[model samples]
Target: MSNIIGFNNAIFWTDDTEILYCEFSNTDPNAKLESTKAKLYIKAITTLCKGKAMPFVIDLTETCGTFTTSVAKFIVRNSELKKLRISESFIIGTTGVKLLITLYKKFYDPATPFRIFADQNLAQAYSLETKQKYHNSIKKVVEDYK
Candidate 1:
């Protein structure tokens, strides 16, 4: 596993098993994850995927940031992003975020498969399984934080 990218409160990378992972920091309780930060995340995912479909795992455990309805819509509306992802996405977070994810799924009905997990290990295992099922590989190009 290698750290390929880092933002203010998040780190993005492809693990040894080839699952794309985005882990948000838990220290900042007041941080708000707005549309701009969402865009940056999209950019990072696009760069990492490089037009290939891969399983994505988001670790939101202990993060205080909240996503607005508009931010969720922004992610769903990103056509380019839609093309580069596998059918499933796994998110790890608290109960509140899990509820939010439920609402998002109900409202958005995203084309991709999305699941929420309270356990990070379970999420990672699922992601790796998905990658293997689809025969995807870890991205070869790794970029340092800019």
Candidate 2:
């Protein structure tokens, strides 16, 4: 079984494998990432994580555009989110995104552990292994996009 939640531009879900998954699309390449949108997305993810430590896999292969430094900082420094997330995060993306993540890692200290991958299957496998190691099985509350 699986649970899905999303907006028009992104989606968050989980399958029986017990990994939290996120995918992005329909993003404006020219637009800066809005803080409100970022917060909303985090709220959705927080709900899915159910305050339990779990592995996360984010598919950024189709995501376009850039977010503000403040948004990135919030994601990396937020104490509440840090507490909710456990295990390593796997990000699936292009070389550019991987470089961005590398730069972010170089400049700022993140609260959660993460790695970037070009292959989704590899990311999934990594997350699955993490989930198994953590023995996490948090149930997600899925909602339809309005």
Candidate 3:
């Protein structure tokens, strides 16, 4: 697990899935969310996968942070983002939250697949399916080489 920039949260990584789990609690209302850690985590996955599929499953079940313009752009530019499974636990119909959701939906292309899950278990199951596909591809490549 990698700590957030401000040590407010910790990102948990797993070889079973590309999901980044951040467990946060009682964060400041107006505090700025540092995404550098998230960026670094994504970079790590990209490096490990080496251009292969790296779908993201963000279990944001306990944190609240406005997705700034820079983060939005980052999400758009990450080509390996096959799926984004976000947990909609704290986010309600607030103005800022709505705006962020609208921006993501507007900017994200239809070809890019994404979904919001209510719990981590469902998200993990979906991630497993994606991992299986990736594993199959690797197996095929190895067999071809043989």
lDDT of 1 by residue, 1-146 (tens): 46488887888887566667888876665566688889998998888776777788887775765667788788888997777666445465567767766777778755677678877788877777776655533333222322
Please give the distance, in angstroms, between residue 84's alpha carbon in candidate 1 and its true position after superposition: 1.7
The Cα RMSD of model 3 versus the native structure comes to 5.7
Indicate which candidate wins on lDDT: 1
Candidate 1 TM-score versus the reference: 0.77
TM-score of every candidate: 0.77, 0.79, 0.56
Candidate 1 error regions (>4 Å): 1-3, 26-31, 87-93, 135-146
Residue-level lDDT of model 2, residues 7-118, one tens digit each, is 9788998777767788877556676678898888888888877777667787777876777899878877877677756545546456766776677766665545677787
Candidate ranking (TM-score, best to worst): 2, 1, 3
lDDT of 1 at 94: 65
In order, the Cα lDDT scores of the candidates are 0.73, 0.72, 0.51
Error of 1 at 116 (Å): 1.7
Cα displacement (angstroms), candidate 2, residue 92, comes to: 4.0
